[model samples]
Target chain A: EDQVTQSPEALRLQEGESSSLNCSYTVSGLRGLFWYRQDPGKGPEFLFTLYSAGEEKEKERLKATLTKKESFLHITAPKPEDSATYLCAVQPPGGTSGSRLTFGEGTQLTVNP
Target chain B: AAGVIQSPRHLIKEKRETATLKCYPIPRHDTVYWYQQGPGQDPQFLISFYEKMQSDKGSIPDRFSAQQFSDYHSELNMSSLELGDSALYFCASSLPNQPQHFGDGTRLSIL
Candidate 1:
């Protein structure tokens, strides 16, 4: 079974503070790694998709990097609005279409202003 | 750009009752996926469809059934609802090998 594990279940930071969340995974053949941000009682919003090691992508205050065995979501100078549960999910290689995602427990980040 | 849209944002049901959740995929996207997230838990894959055909299955209960229509819309039919069925159900859509975009989700509550 494909598995994903995220470190630092909960994190607290002051406004403008920077930090990185980690997600480790084990899959038969990784097709993609995804990052999503979810607010309380809300569906996850898409963040980034890292397809290969040494790949990195960024969006505003967030940057995502992937390695062969893990991925990192680096929050740069975060603000209170950036606080949310960050989720990491992995997609395994599959046939035709619509591969399922295996998600980690997630890291709840709280940025205090 | 349009995002995945889910209907009946919230539903309340009693045990043994049935409920249906609907999803409209983003335009030009052909794959739809269903996921269930319990309180304080990450979303769990339930099922998926592509090109109006069932393409994958996961931890979905036997009482739950879902299908994608010709219009690329999908519905999840859940029967014999139990308290354990209460959760946030999310629908996502994407093109082949692309990142899936999620809907706001339907919050289901069983009493």
Candidate 2:
């Protein structure tokens, strides 16, 4: 079965605190890794796409890095508004180049002022 | 421009009834997909429509069916709805296998 396990299911941090979330997966064939931010009562918003090992993508205080077996979402000096569920998903074999994403359960981050 | 549009933002139905959810893909996209997300769970794929045909079907039961039109719009129909059918159904669109842009989703409550 294709599976994605995310670590530290939930995280709470003071404003400006930095942390990292992990996503490890088992897929039939790996094509790409993606990160999304979903606020309560809203659809997930795309954040980044990593196409290969050693590749990294960044936006604002969030940065995503990929490896052969895992990916990391690193938040630097996060603000309260950044508090939301961060989801990591992988596109496996069977679908086209960028097909349906197999998502993880997501990590909920609460940033406090 | 709209990324994706799904109608009936919220629906309440009784068990054994039928419900049809509609989706209009982005004008530039050619693929439409459906997914169900239950509370506290990740989204699960239900089905997908591409080129007026079914391209992918997930582990959902037989009660669920889908249709696509020439314009690339799609509909997901659930017959004999059950209590477990309550969920947020999201419609998304994209190029063949590209990253999908999603709609706000429909919240269904099967009583």
Instruction: Report lDDT per candidate.
Output: 0.96, 0.87
For model 2, state the Cα shift of residue A29 in Å.
0.6
Residues B70-108, candidate 1, lDDT per residue (tens digit)?
899999999999999999999999998788899999999
Per-residue accuracy of model 1 over A44-71 as CA lDDT, tens digit each: 8999999999999999999999999999
Predicted candidate 2 versus true structure: per-residue lDDT over B1-111, tens digit per residue: 767889889999999999999999889688888889999888888887778777777876899888889888899889999999999998988887577788889999999
- Top candidate on TM-score is 1
The deviation in Å at residue A7 for candidate 2 is 1.4
| DockQ-based CAPRI category assigned to the predicted complex of candidate 2 | medium
lDDT of 2 at B92: 84
Top model number, DockQ: 1
Candidate 2 chain A: worst 10 consecutive residues by lDDT? A91-100
True contacts kept of 2: 0.32
Model 2 chain B weakest lDDT span, ten residues long: B51-60
